[model samples]
Target: PEVIYLAGIIDRTPSSIAMRLVNFASVDPFHQNRGIAGLSGGKKQVEPIWKEFIDNKEDLLFESEKILAEKESVSIDKKFAHMLIGIENLVGESKTREVKVRVNQSVFRQIVLANYSSKCAISGIDVPELLVASHIIPWSKNEKERLNPENGICLSSMYDKAFDKGLIGLKLDHSIVISEKLRSNRIKPYYKQFFAPLEKLKIASPQKYLPKPEFLEYHLDVVFMK
Candidate 1:
């Protein structure tokens, strides 16, 4: 349905839209590493756009959303009205900055959700409201990779807070690791039901943009509780 909707807006067939996505997969490092090949002929055509996304994700993603909104005959502000609430009074550069941040954050969440098939990587929770686009590296700590899909993980709200607080972490192999702080509560029912089961368990692999090893290492070194 989404492909058909996008195809109608772009004046392309659904097959073509799907093929374009495949072309994107062709250049994706995750797919390439897994030996999956997309249509080779269109790979070159998508390379430049992919490179641009890698270089300046914030601008590219926001502009892409704006373009989509325009093509659908809607203002970007209207399209994202739900997220723009409470920012109406601000004017000038501050307003622009805040809007961009909110929109980009929305885009990041969408990408992470799509990558994980809209399920939490740890708990497999499929409820959208319960999910979060958890950053492996603290967002404030890494500006360059702030919007990188490889730096994000799909997690339930409980695990997201746990991760953010360094109460849980991921090993390089993608297995969950419980912090000693969390393990200290092993005798508690909540710990028995939640934290204990997750220890050393592998997270579900994303469809694309697997978390980068470097980002995981950074989390382990700086964010993870020893």
Candidate 2:
């Protein structure tokens, strides 16, 4: 029933629906390209649809990245592209949906990295290998908003742990806000040295990914552990 309900809102066909699902799963364009192209060519009509979706989806993704850098929302068409991703989930029995979600997810990470200069947005620590573009909103919680760049943050291993734990959080204004619970004598000096300085840290100047306040609120209430 839910899938049928989901199908009503789907604007694209089943194959395209599958493609979008696949795109968000891995976040790798090269992989997605290979997978999308692997489908049988005898289905000529689907080809055009797939091609259009690929082009439009890439365009929309890049546009979203640009807006994230600018700390703004994508233009209307671009926004529609994102909104239309739901169609991918309803595409009959096709595998494209699974692959699309993966590819797009990879792209999302790259966008977040570039936007934050491959560094932790809060601590200014630059360690590409150890950093992750962590989601402000967990992926399982909101399917419609999952691909959104604004729902993510770039943080190093330690800081991500702290952020995920809610030992600290960022103000809507991007200033630092250490949870009052963490201000105790048992607090690690490392917290004082690294995270404490962050209390005054200006939210990283958004490049391609301004943090979304709505998801940030989720962090403050649920995921931030504090």
Candidate 3:
């Protein structure tokens, strides 16, 4: 139904759109690794766009959103009015930078959520309101990778806080590792009911852009409690 609606808006057949999606999947590394051969004929057309996304995610993602807004006959600012509310008073480079940052952050969240199929990677929570695009490497610590899909993880609010605060971490194998601080509370009801069950459990693999091992190492070295 969604594909049909999109096809109507774009004046194309639903099959065409479906095939295009398959083409995109063909170019996706995750699908490639899984031995899924999606519409190879259209792969070349989508490959360049995928390369551009990997090379310059922030700019490409913002431009894509802007283009979508234009296609809908709306201004980018108006399309993201709620998220861009507080920047009205600013102008010039400062305003431009702020707008780009906010828009790109929103795009990052969308990409991360889609990667995880809109479910929390750890707990499989499917409620969008309870999910967050948690950064493996702190956003402030890496400007170049701030918007990288590989640097993000979908997690529920509770686990997001736990991961952010070093109460829990992920090993190179993607298994959960409880901090000694959290482990100290093992006898507590909450620990037994929540934290204990997660210890050494592997997170659900994302559909695309698995978290980079380097980012996981950074989190282990710099953020995880001993």
Candidate 4:
């Protein structure tokens, strides 16, 4: 990921990156030792990959426990005991790296929901299952912002689709901006009911997450048809 590679550049020379990768790949029991040995770079060349893997591993080990904490998600907390049982399935002989991915996603979702009071940012819909922690900046476009809560906005399923497709955008001041097409559509009333009022509403919980201005600008300029 860009964040991983960037950190490698910041912290280590190219030669160190290479050697570290070989060493990590060799010692990681889950990976084949032969593959590690086949890697033929100095420490600098392998630094990026090594750093990322180590970082992910550390996050998994540390943050996975935090997942059980009630502050993250009330729903998850209510069923925390059951969740622990499911997590146990991934431990020991059944352990898989995918478990970490699941945990990461959970963490992201909790962060988003907590920030929005489990309500959609635009529609104020409070249905937990229907809400999404949609990234303001496309997740694939920015690795550095991948897990940044400020990079996310809580959105309902329908509005999430609209926002993701650029049918709507938010001004830096957090006012809703409807695309001309949407404003002119027959469904304008429906849109107005849920979205138009947002223009006047200050962000409900600015403390939970602040939308990145650059990402908002990207949506306004490129994504919103207007």
Candidate 5:
């Protein structure tokens, strides 16, 4: 329940355990890649705890990791369900819904990652830590599209941020669209070598859940800088 208790068991400081959980969540290299939002604080902390457990799950002594994984998964699922219902019921009176939103975002990322085969659609970066589940339409623009995998794309973190800030966009053909504004920064080696080279390069489309054209249209109209 308390970090002190966990610290004693693990022979780590309370603060160290807490910080290490963040590190564990940061680099899962496994199924789900959790950002700080999904991995830090309260009920969502269980996700990171599981992330740590998974890192050490390969025990030769016994199936300790397997046991903990199943146990924690069940507990987290039940607790998360109750937490969501509670937050939904208390929407106006409390801020618990924010936690639910974080969980939803994490699940949304997992779905998008699966859709894109856990690599960046544009750069083909396979490192989970470097990829992001980017929304075609800005998340703030469409509530319904927030969790829709068909409205998501896997992009490397740089490309994701670039797409978000509209340093780049996608044409209807799923090709890269670099903004003319980048011309000023084009002197940067990475800009010329990596970013500029991406212009007109086609993004990798999902095999199972193709992104919606309307979402692409919305992104082009509202989010894309040019």
Candidate 6:
């Protein structure tokens, strides 16, 4: 998530990312001795395979709990503070800034995936690593929908970025709408090649919480570039 939100790379959920970390730990040479025994079982294996984990359960549990909290979507307050600090050099990042809200990213993802069937609304990319929960209404614009899953859509990274930049948007009928700028030859060839064809393509319909028409309208009128 640090890589995802902060750096905008490696589009994956916390759980999928956690598994990758576990795989890396298995081969990490520095922690070889401390690492759990590999599959094929330890030599002579007198103790149970789960012994190490069982014995350290309390310590591991505590650490896992910390990770879980971190995995949850950041509180809206923390998110705002972080953004403000980056943009305005906010010192101490104001924990008391009345807008202290946290966003549980995992929960948000779950809700978005539930709505969009765990795939990009435009491209239908099923690979979890390439997907993001995009807000139909910009996060800063709608405080109430900051963590509201109904306000989110599962979009691939490219589409997400384009949508955020107002280069593209969803029509009232849920089709993709490419902005006129992207259609200009002045734009890169790839921009026209990639986005031009998406115009009027109906996005995958959400199963449950269809994005509120007002939110879509807000994006179209306020956020989308004409």
For each candidate, give its TM-score against the true structure. Answer: 0.89, 0.54, 0.82, 0.56, 0.60, 0.55
TM-score computed on alpha carbons, candidate 6: 0.55
Better of 2 and 6 by TM-score: 6
**Model 3 misses residue 85 by how many Å?**
3.7
Write one digit per residue (lDDT tens) for candidate 1, span 64-171.
989999999999889999889999999999988888888999989999999999999999999999999999999899988989899999999999999999999999
Model 1 lDDT at residue 166: 95
Off by over 4 Å in 2: 1-102, 185-187
Which wins on TM-score, candidate 1 or candidate 4? 1
Cα lDDT listed for each candidate: 0.92, 0.65, 0.91, 0.66, 0.70, 0.66
Residues 138-223 of candidate 3 have per-residue lDDT tens digits of 99999889998899999999999999998999999999999999999999999999888997799999987889999999999999
Count steric clashes of candidate 5.
0
Q: Pick the candidate with the highest lDDT.
A: 1
Please state every model's RMSD to the true fold in angstroms. Answer: 2.1, 16.2, 2.8, 13.3, 14.6, 14.8
For model 5, what is the C-alpha lDDT against the true structure? 0.70
lDDT of prediction 6: 0.66
Report the number of the highest-TM-score candidate. 1
- For model 2, where is the 10-residue window of minimal lDDT? 71-80
Over 4 Å off, model 4: 1-98, 186-189, 195-202
Off by over 4 Å in 5: 1-73, 77-95
Tell me how many clashing residue pairs each candidate has: 0, 39, 0, 18, 0, 13
Model 6 misplaced stretches (Cα beyond 4 Å): 1-103, 186-189
Residue-wise lDDT of candidate 5 within 86-133, one digit each (tens)? 554455525443544655666678889988999999878999989899
